[model samples]
Target: MTTAPPDSHPPAAPPSTDVEALRREVATLREESSRLRRMLDTAARIAWSHDVRAGGGEPVAPAWQAFTGQSLEAFGNQGWLTVLHPDDRAGALASWADAVAAKRSFSTRYRVRRADGVYVWMLAKGTPVLGLDGEVQEWVGTCSDIQDQCLREERAAFLARAGELFSSSLDAAATLATLANLSVSAHADWCLVDLLHEDGHFERSLVVTADPAQLPLATIVRSLSPVPRDQPVYPPSVALTTGRSTLVPEVTAPLLEAVAQDANHLATMHQVGMRSLLTVPLMARGHILGALTFIITKSGRHYGDEDLQFAQELANLAALAVDNARLLQGARDAIRLRDEFLSVASHELKTPLTPLSLKLQVLSRAVKAHPDSPLAPVIEAHVETGHRQVRRLTELMNDLLDVSRISAGTFRLQREAMDVAALVREVSARFAPRFALEHCPFTVDAPESVPGCFDKPRLAQVLDHLLDNALKYGAGTPVSLTLTADGAAARIRVRDGGIGIAPEQRSRLFERYGRAVSERHYGGLGLGLYLTRTIVEAEGGRVSLESRPGEGAEFEVMLPLQQA
Candidate 1:
């Protein structure tokens, strides 16, 4: 064999052989291209291209048949337009026209009806190709299915607006009306708000119109109850009583039969067109204030937990508004009562002051004229009684002024570091003589070195009021004053073996003008405990009480220890 030399080059292939190799390579390229085409054809989404100016060039791409289950010829010359929803057709066309006119990329989302009559949201995006001269040549695009995304966005927007409406207004009636309007607008249904009356009944206060004129007046009149709780069927009284949200779907024949016994059932059914009902209890401070009822008329749609929860939230806000309104009304009534009391008190004080002043003037002259006579003692006694009356008047005026100052946030405290034990002992000793006069046993237990920071005058005033209460209420019973301390705080407890407070009255014990029902037995303006709480709280301390009916009451004041 004539083998080539180690350094020599090999002979070149013949032209025929080279041609055959090139042919094989071209065949492989063609096979690969065919495989890629098959893959694209199998994709769910259709890929397409179009010339901007040449509108009807290639009727439909091959991929359209795979995606839509239709032949390419079916969409000849913009025939795909027929598949667009009528509501979306105009907008889609306008958008395409605008994009072509501006020579810009086009992107849009719209609903397209499939051949099977199912509508789906489609997201279409296409970019216009340009020549070197900036003239539009061809366009490339893809269509993606986005039905679920669109629905979610729509629901989210509805929820956001509903939340805004629920939080924006503080008037229950206005809020309910707004909620009704929102319900009708969002769900495209008739809405109703039935508020529970104090007498345990449901009254429709607000109605949103789907068709106001067509609403059956007789049906509404008959179906609604001024006393829903008294009825046997479709009653909302239980929900209102328990403060719960209730949903009733499609008033079945049995429910209708049960409610038919009531005269209002027919009228209510007619008025509300009630196919489904959702009842939400409006509650304030754990009590049922009312009920919010929504009636859906157009469809037999059942209210789900989500719908009930939303309604409940609205009801809760409405309940707060209702409570606020009630509080405002109560305040107005209290102001009126306070004004009347002030007028009466002013007259009473004036009546005493006139005689007191006259007596003091006469006694002063008489005492000067008969300084050594026995008549001086009689005049002096009369003078002292007049002075006591004057002092009482002064105290009433001071109490009223102090209350006003505290309410206006202008009350000032003169704070000082002092021995709390010493203060307690001094106050107790002062009250000891009073206890002796009343024949009541008194005890004081003051721990040495119990120091705290507080306003001495204010704390003394608190102690005076507490001792007064003990004397006034614990007549003929033992009263105790005890001072105790922990590392961080000091406490002074004044307890009395007096008539204790009722459980129901304890919560309002510190509220201004709050007096127990048995207050008629005690002579006071009801400002003592309120003032005490205010003074203590201002010094960064707290006052609390422990007692039960028939047992003695103990008032405990805790003050934070000031760092040395």
Candidate 2:
């Protein structure tokens, strides 16, 4: 990209002799080269040419001095390295050397010191200028300042990293760590994430600094910050109370005097060379969760309006994390409370079952002994009714205990080798009198011996629920209990000829407190089917039902033969 130099002299009038002609040609070429150099500099591009034979030399073009406001004497051969950023100097030099040795073009990005002493990003490049016979002559290149574009790209990268971190986890601690790492990038020297408690007290949840050595000191100082809201001294505290952002662009003496709560905090601020600060409240669903604090110190970086906007974006992610953690914690607390209540309530209701059962037994024995008496028939009938009532009460209490065990995560079964078919027959016999009372025919089809390992009482309870469900809903319909088994598992079926379940009701019939029919027509705790399913699954089994409106419902319980 050569152009005419500001100072150029036209070739002298042609000479009549050979020596004069050669001299005139040389002067003409020199003026043309000077004009090209001037054009390159005027374009605001640093055009440089290094002598390949000398290995390296002062730039043949004066573009560097013209653009940077530095003299060529100041940038003698290889002196350009002095103005390069220390981190980029070694690499830039090595690249130049390799390009020259290989006689090829080279390009790289590095930060160069401008005349104003500010470092600006530059794209340095070089291309070999070949002579006749394909011999390398010089390396020509230009350096274009790309500082503003580079800054913009870096900022975009920072925001992308922050977004990735926020989406990676829901844990509060991990989210805090992400925020800390984001600040470590060019944004700030230190970052802190704080959470407000239910009582409106601030908890310094996390504090991080890009400088590893300063982390401990930052943590200690943060622990003592957020002075009383009435004082509203620190930026973090002010941001929290107002539900807005606070900025301390310059930590001047007057600013420190007002911000610091005491000498200890002030000393820490000075020790950390805190200069600029921004604190934005972490808000979630219109609720202030906490604050995200960012600090710039001796790094000379200051907070600006764009920085405030960036900080608020980061704060939003922090707020979402805080809100998610709070919700999970609240759910846990509620479950804990519910389990405790279930345990207490079950024990209280079960306490009276023992005495009630004993009293019913005593009454039966007395009526049996007075069978020949005149009022024997009526007394026997009353005793039988009492027995049925006692049985109902016992089932109710047992359901409560099962629910409590399930809530406590302590539901267990005592496995014993037995004939499952025989067990079913025994439980069915207990329901015979009730079937007779309701004028419903009852039947049981069970094999003589279908061996398996199971909790006898739990199986009996399951049978009680299935049979009772049938009798209650299918009151006048015939109720049948059947047991069958293959080599791998045993299956029990309870089918009733009553009003079938509706589609909507059947779906939720197995849920706790779920009722398929109105209480006015049928009475139950609605835990029968739920407990049935729970106990069956706990024993490595499954329960399912097929029902249709106006048809009948058939419940099938399958239990695996093997139990561990």
Candidate 3:
């Protein structure tokens, strides 16, 4: 080797310290490059750099491949442009061109096709590199996936639109129809509404965008279920009862399999290609009124919390609208009935008045003609009977007029400072004779002084109705009237030991035209308690009742006491 020529030995002669230094420098550069690559990979976005003039560049960085599942050969040399959404292509290219011409940073949001062929929103941003002469050199940019953000925005928009539609209409049918149409537009396959009846049964009120045949069969089957007369199948009823939304991912396999095995849910699911369902409760003032069911069929999409919340809001609006419509219909019906009743009542009242006036005139003439005739006593008794009948007719007319006034909001109260005790005493004295006539014992308990500001005539009317109801329904049982003062309030309670009201009917007893079935047998208009409540409330007071079937009923009136 020592004897070899310099040419053959080549670099062996330059075994110097600089060689080790160069090796160290190269190793340091390699480590730096690896560190930069890892930093880019760890970032949420994928990075790329391209020369504007060359129109050719290195393939996408490793991060780009990881994000899009595409290789360098597939994306380099403008090949990656194919992955952009068709709708976004023109805008994206225009943005890039503007950025290049202006020699400034560029940023834009557009849609890109993923490896699975699903278009997803993405944000791309880049800054231009410049040479010493200020000419553009290259563009370095990143693309960040924003699909989740875009979907959230879309969902928010859909909910806003739904709110606008539901809140604008009061027609129950139109509202339900709008809801169904919106559901369909929002990608639901079918929607149906079921309303609960007073008898605790559910009846299909509307079916939107659902198969016609399925509607009839579904309703018939639901009506025939063994659960109860007014209850729906378990899942739907549970949602209604609990006032919560229920989501069943696979209804046929898990939910329907348990209770409604023979239900045509499986066939319906196949026909509609449904895989998930949502049932939302419709409630107003804590009472379950109905339910709305939405089915997702085209795609087996699992409904999430967001979807449930949206559907629940829609159901809530629809429920309120339906409840309002029902109330309006009830009011119209009440007015119609009231008109008819008034016509009949006017005719009956005239019949009694005519005879009453004639009897009084005859009595006056007979008394003037014979001063000592034996027929005087008989005439006097007959005149007294006529007077009682006339009084009864007058009371009936007053009750009807009071009801109408209360309904029209024209009933104004005349407030006066009075002793509640004295008023109660006066009403008790007046009712004492009637109680004796009916052979019903009556008792009164009161404080020496129960001062309150109240409407005297209205209060008297209320007491009279309470006493009459107690006497009529008490079935010869003792009736007790009590008056007391409790810290800034006066309390008057009338209790009767008679057939009491059912617990279920107590809530509606004070409502207009509301009466217990037991009370209906007593043969009177159902406006007594309604008028009583209206008068009490107008005077800034409240009335409540407590009773149980076969145990007697207690009615309490509370009025604010006058300040000392």
Candidate 4:
């Protein structure tokens, strides 16, 4: 036990604690903790940590407590799953457990209850922090708010589907029903469409629900007096009257009672389990078409401003489709009426014209017989003018009859073996007088024998229309008609040096009642080209136009030599 020298021996035992070193270590830990808290606060990431060994009994992070309004004591033992949506909890737990067992990364999506009681969608991801032994020490994760993004994606998909469904049909009632059904299947538990009649009363156009078993109840609800105008508190009535959207996020008993009509209605309303209501006016072209009502029931969805906006968008599409259907129906009705009138009038007028034409011919013969008399020339001229006028009237009546036949799908062709060149020459000869009257030069280039099996009368009529247009629009310029046998088809071209069609007007030239020039300036019905095209196509031929503004126009008709 000899005492060692001061230099070799260890220094006298230090103080019980090195105060400076301990203080520095404590300061460093506090700075680290403050830095972590600042990082968590600044990022959208909601930082959370779970003790791997503690299992369900582990304490939750302060961020989780703050974000979800779950305190450590409240979250004790049960784990964070207690705060998750019932539908999402099991899936989230399964994914998290798998990641923990494998000691790897974890990722999942879930709906968690917020302080405001709304279950918001979140994307949570975690990375296992391993100890030195390579076992999982803990799990560090962050939950990002994805509710708005999820809703936006869902809404976009729904609108795309709705657009397709609405545009698929043109029937007004069917389109309305589709809207209601689509709304129920996508966003709402129940949907109803109410149309406003001309008498200012509402008619329940349709009602649809997500649950088929509830259809009977939905029918009863639909049958309920179509949202009386007196009840301004009713969602549909309010929307229709104000022509604005209405949203009730929460449907309270008092509100239901306020809107219910009678005891049974009230009881039925209660049974409906309405959690929310949204109504939007269906409007088009400055008129209110109807009201579209959406209701959330056992689905537990609340109507917010965003939902109201979506409902209004849907209402706009439905209204447009309904209005378009109505317009189309009205047009069809008008066309039918016009066709009926034309069919009756043409026959009635033609009945008198036959006898009238006979009388004109008799008078013309009697006047010609008195050619030696002084007044014979004057009377003969008058009679000839009467004959011309009757012919013009007959042509007009025939045109109207042809139009009616085409519209009714009764236009038929009597095909025969005939020379198309002879037909073209005959039609050109008929227009010679008119071309001379207008001082327009006309020419026809054709082979003497261009025979084909075709509808001779219809082909003659087609040539007649083309020559008539050339004579009228030739503007006193040269007009040419060329017919040839090209391969297995017969080609006829009528070229006119007159006011040519504009590019845009050419497309409408063959449509019924379509005209490029003003009717006030030109004196003929606009049906000539339409009839020509119909007759030509019926004979297994096609008519095409080549024209430009301020230039000449050329119309070509290609007819199959052997009709099939």
Off by over 4 Å in 4: 1-15, 18-119, 130-136, 156-171, 227-231, 343-345, 367-380, 408-410, 414-417, 436-441, 501-504, 547-551
Q: Which candidate should be chosen as best, given lDDT against the real structure?
A: 4
lDDT scores of the candidates, listed in order: 0.72, 0.81, 0.75, 0.84
Cα displacement (angstroms), candidate 4, residue 167, comes to: 5.9
TM-score rank, highest first? 4, 2, 3, 1
Writing each residue's lDDT as its tens digit, candidate 1 over 58-110 gives: 42356565556555566767667777888898888888789889989888988
Tens-place lDDT per residue, model 3, 163-228, is 677668766777777877777666476776777766886666665654565566445434432232
**TM-scores for all predictions:** 0.47, 0.75, 0.49, 0.80
Candidate 2, which ten residues in sequence have the lowest lDDT sum?
59-68
Better of 2 and 3 by lDDT: 2
Which candidate number maximizes TM-score? Answer: 4
Tens-digit lDDT track for model 4 on 275-365? 9998999999988889998898875468899998988888888899999998899899899899989989988998998998899889888
Better of 1 and 2 by lDDT: 2
Model 1 segments more than 4 A misplaced: 1-94, 102-170, 197-202, 210-223, 229-238, 241-264, 271-276, 284-286, 298-305, 320-564
Q: Model 3: clashing residue pairs?
A: 200-230, 201-230
TM-score for predicted model 4 compared with the true structure: 0.80
* lDDT, residue 415, candidate 3: 81
- Where in model 2 is the C-alpha error above 4 Å? 1-54, 57-174, 372-394, 435-442, 471-479, 497-526, 545-551
Q: Which whole-number lDDT from 0 to 100 does residue 238 have in model 4?
A: 75
